[model samples]
Target: MIIMWKNDITKEIEKKRLKIRKDEDLFETVEEVFDTRTLMALYRIINKGIISEMRGVVKSGKESRVYWAKDKNDNDIAVKIYLTSSMEFRKSIFQYIQGDPRFKVVKDYRKMIYTWAQKEYKNLQIAYEVNVSVPKPIYVYENILVMEFIGENGVPAPLLKDLSVINIELFNQIIDAIKKLYNKAKIIHADLSEYNIMVRNNKIYIIDFGQAVTIEHPMSYEFLLRDIKNIVRFFRKNGIDVPDDEVIIKWIKEV
Candidate 1:
């Protein structure tokens, strides 16, 4: 004979969690509609102490959901959890990972997103190596990526596009930072735009490196030029008269 205590009935309580399903704001609505398996994956991560507490769901992107979590030391960490769905990612991922040596083995859509997250982890590693102020990647398991939370207390830094840094000082620093990124990293952040860069303490911190690509890749120059174009466009939008081609050339030959 065996008896189960109140705490022993935790699984039964968690069974009610089946009601959880796809977040409408997320890129994909749940395919299975309240899949116990996906929930189990989330449970496994939580149980492993990777994140001691997960707060409110933050912004949802085209492929992942951003969550604010607290670690063992009570420090905040940003968790980018990729949705299990893949229809959207299948279309655009090829451009970023086409020449990635680590991704040659990945063939399926689901595998591709996981590979994308892995790529992001590697990109962060490269950036940090060169002293770029992106988030410090902690752990990336499957679709989940845990990184240093870019915030203090409860406020995250506002993105560059959201704030104004008036003066040549801020602009020049941004240009210099891009120079380091291009020269040292030998990679271009393909999707970089004003919205993905953060301005904190009058310095720039680039984020969202998922689309960063190698310099030798066929699309590398295309991506590099596009990045320079976007940066120039942003600054020009803010009333700065600058030449996109000149900025690209300056970074290439003058840096």
Candidate 2:
């Protein structure tokens, strides 16, 4: 009976896989990463009417893959799926998870990945609610997260690192976002850099919040300082005049 149930699930996923394979961009990724469990989680999200269709891969990384998808209204959305089999991901996320007060660390590796996805969704929710420039989180289940897509069609916005022109206004906007995130949300974006910031039509959106932590974390200050340094370094390198890291940190922490 158990074997029959498992086969049924596999057959269902295979049917969906055939449909997804029609998109050449998503075909390789679906085959590469969509294990039975991950596919099941995604299937559940689709069944819930949150995701109407899965399109192409927008971003691929060691820990997760972001796909360009559409909602029931045909609006573009991003689907981030964390790789459950990534042992290295477990080690890298431990520091942030250990210090975060919101979550309890789990020994089960798959469970930890789910926690990480949930953490990112919660962090995005907190930041968005505080009016910080971030992807508006829609839903999260197991290792999958659904959010507003920051780009048009299937193409993602240019990263800050890819931009040719940098101006003080852009720099100030990011700093203000950081300040809002720190003061209003009371969370630190532990990993902030040019690579994770998206620029589109003069607007900026910060992405990837899996490692963010609350201000109550033991290493929160250090993480905050690091985030500040990263932004300052990137702006300064682009010939934009920015304040010292210490000055920015002081301002962000101020009420």
Q: Runs in model 1 with CA error above 4 Å?
A: 1-38, 241-244, 253-255
Give all TM-scores, in the order shown: 0.80, 0.89
Q: What's the number of clashes in each of the models?
A: 0, 0
lDDT of model 1, residue 25: 22
lDDT per residue for candidate 1 within 111-152, as digits (tens), equals: 777788888988888888888778888888777788888866
Residue-level error in angstroms, candidate 1, position 146:
0.6
- RMSD to native for every prediction? 4.9, 5.8
How well does model 1 score by local distance difference test? 0.72
**lDDT (Cα, tens digit) per residue for candidate 2, span 1-255:** 355688889998998887766444444546567688888788789889999888888888888889999999999999999998887897898888998878999988888889999999999999999999898999999999999999898899999999988898888888999899889999989899998899989899999999999999999888899898999888888888889988888888899
Off by over 4 Å in 2: 1-29
